[model samples]
Target: MSEPRWLTDEEQHVWREFSVATRMLQAHLEGQLQHESNMPHTYYEVLVALSEAPEHRLRMSELADARKSSRSRLSHAVSRLEANGWVRRESCPTDKRGAWAVLTAEGFAAIKAAAPGHVEAVRESLFGPLTAEQVVALGEISTAIREGLSPRCAAAAAAAEAESACAGEVPEESFGVA
Candidate 1:
């Protein structure tokens, strides 16, 4: 086998800093959401995804794919949300084995109430510390990284572009990765 490639000192330093920043940022966001909204970051993401979906509903498999979560995890989360009166599951009329997650009016209210604080927390923790140029660069860097990591995302982008052209509507943001 070929010898393994190793990071140089400078590369190592950059990698370490990137790892720490990612971890800390996630932790801070999760904590802030939990404290302010009484919901975990994942739950907030689910609500956001559903809220943005057409008719405030998405197929369960599509939701799972968007969230990058496994079937079991999504099922459990949906169960919890259902218990909280934020989401309800309905059997797909066309597919007996398929299901859809529908956001309720209560869920809409919950998201509306949570949005301001969540946005403020995100602003304070991320954008507040970065210059405008840095923010734009960060977005570019993030998209590049995501595209590199997930080939499917590139395909999805192309599909979205075609769909957008035909429908005359912009694709909604996918909150699954966040």
Candidate 2:
């Protein structure tokens, strides 16, 4: 095998900056949503996905894909939203295993009430400090990152021991190697 290519100082700096910036942004957004909307950022994302779907409904699988989430996790989130009367589940007639997640009128109202503050929070946290050109650059960078980690690349990464699902403080024995 060829020798491993290690990151230079500049590359390491750039990586750290990008990683910390994303984490900080998510933390800020999460705190804002939890405080103002009484929902976590993940739940808000689900509601937004459902609200944008045709007739405010999507197949459970589609919802999971939209959220980039697994079926079991999405099911748990749906259950929570259903309990809050923000969403309802209906079995699909064509596919017994398939179901639809439907946003209710109350859910629509809840989202509408939540949107203004959420948008403002996003603006303050993300767009407020950036120049117009920087905002454009941010969009390009985000899209590139998303495409780079698409399923094809993800599979290759996993086979290479890339540990895509790990967070900080995980044990090497319990989790995969670094």
Candidate 3:
């Protein structure tokens, strides 16, 4: 194998800070959702995706992709949400193995209830410390890094956009970073 390129001192420092920040933010949000919203952050994201989709539904695979989730992981989450009456699965008539994740009325209401606290948590943990200029810069930096790291990400994004269900713009309330 070829020798790996080593990070410079500054690169190393930036990477460490970025890694820690992402992990800490995720942990903070996860704990907040579990404690205050009575749901995991992952489930909340699923509900939000479905709630935003047309007819409050998306194909199972699409949902998994949107959430960066494995098939089995998404399936497990759907099962848990199903038990909570927050989501339901409907088999596709045209494709036997295909299925849809549909948000129930209860799910919509749950998201509605959970959203305020969730957004607040995000703002507090993520945006509260940043100035407006810093926020914009961070968003740009994040997107540039993401696009650089994953060559197929743009293609996947375009596919999601063509489908139009899984890639809708987040409303201003969600901060629209996505």
TM-scores of the models, in the given order?
A: 0.83, 0.84, 0.82
Ranking by TM-score: 2, 1, 3
Could you give the candidate ranking by lDDT, starting with the highest? 1, 3, 2
lDDT (0 to 1) per candidate: 0.84, 0.80, 0.83
Error of 3 at 138 (Å): 0.8
lDDT of 2 by residue, 1-178 (tens): 9999999999999999989988999999999888988998888999999899999998876787788775566788888888999999887787665678899998898889889999998999899999999999999999998897897655763453334235443221221111
Q: How many clashes show up per model?
A: 0, 0, 0
In candidate 3 the C-alpha lDDT for residue 34 amounts to: 92
* Candidate 2: C-alpha lDDT: 0.80
* 149: Cα error in model 1, Å: 0.6
Q: For model 1, what is the error of residue 91's alpha carbon versus the real structure, in angstroms, after optimal superposition?
A: 0.4
lDDT (Cα, 0-100) at 23 in candidate 1:
96
RMSD vs true structure, all candidates: 8.9, 8.1, 9.2
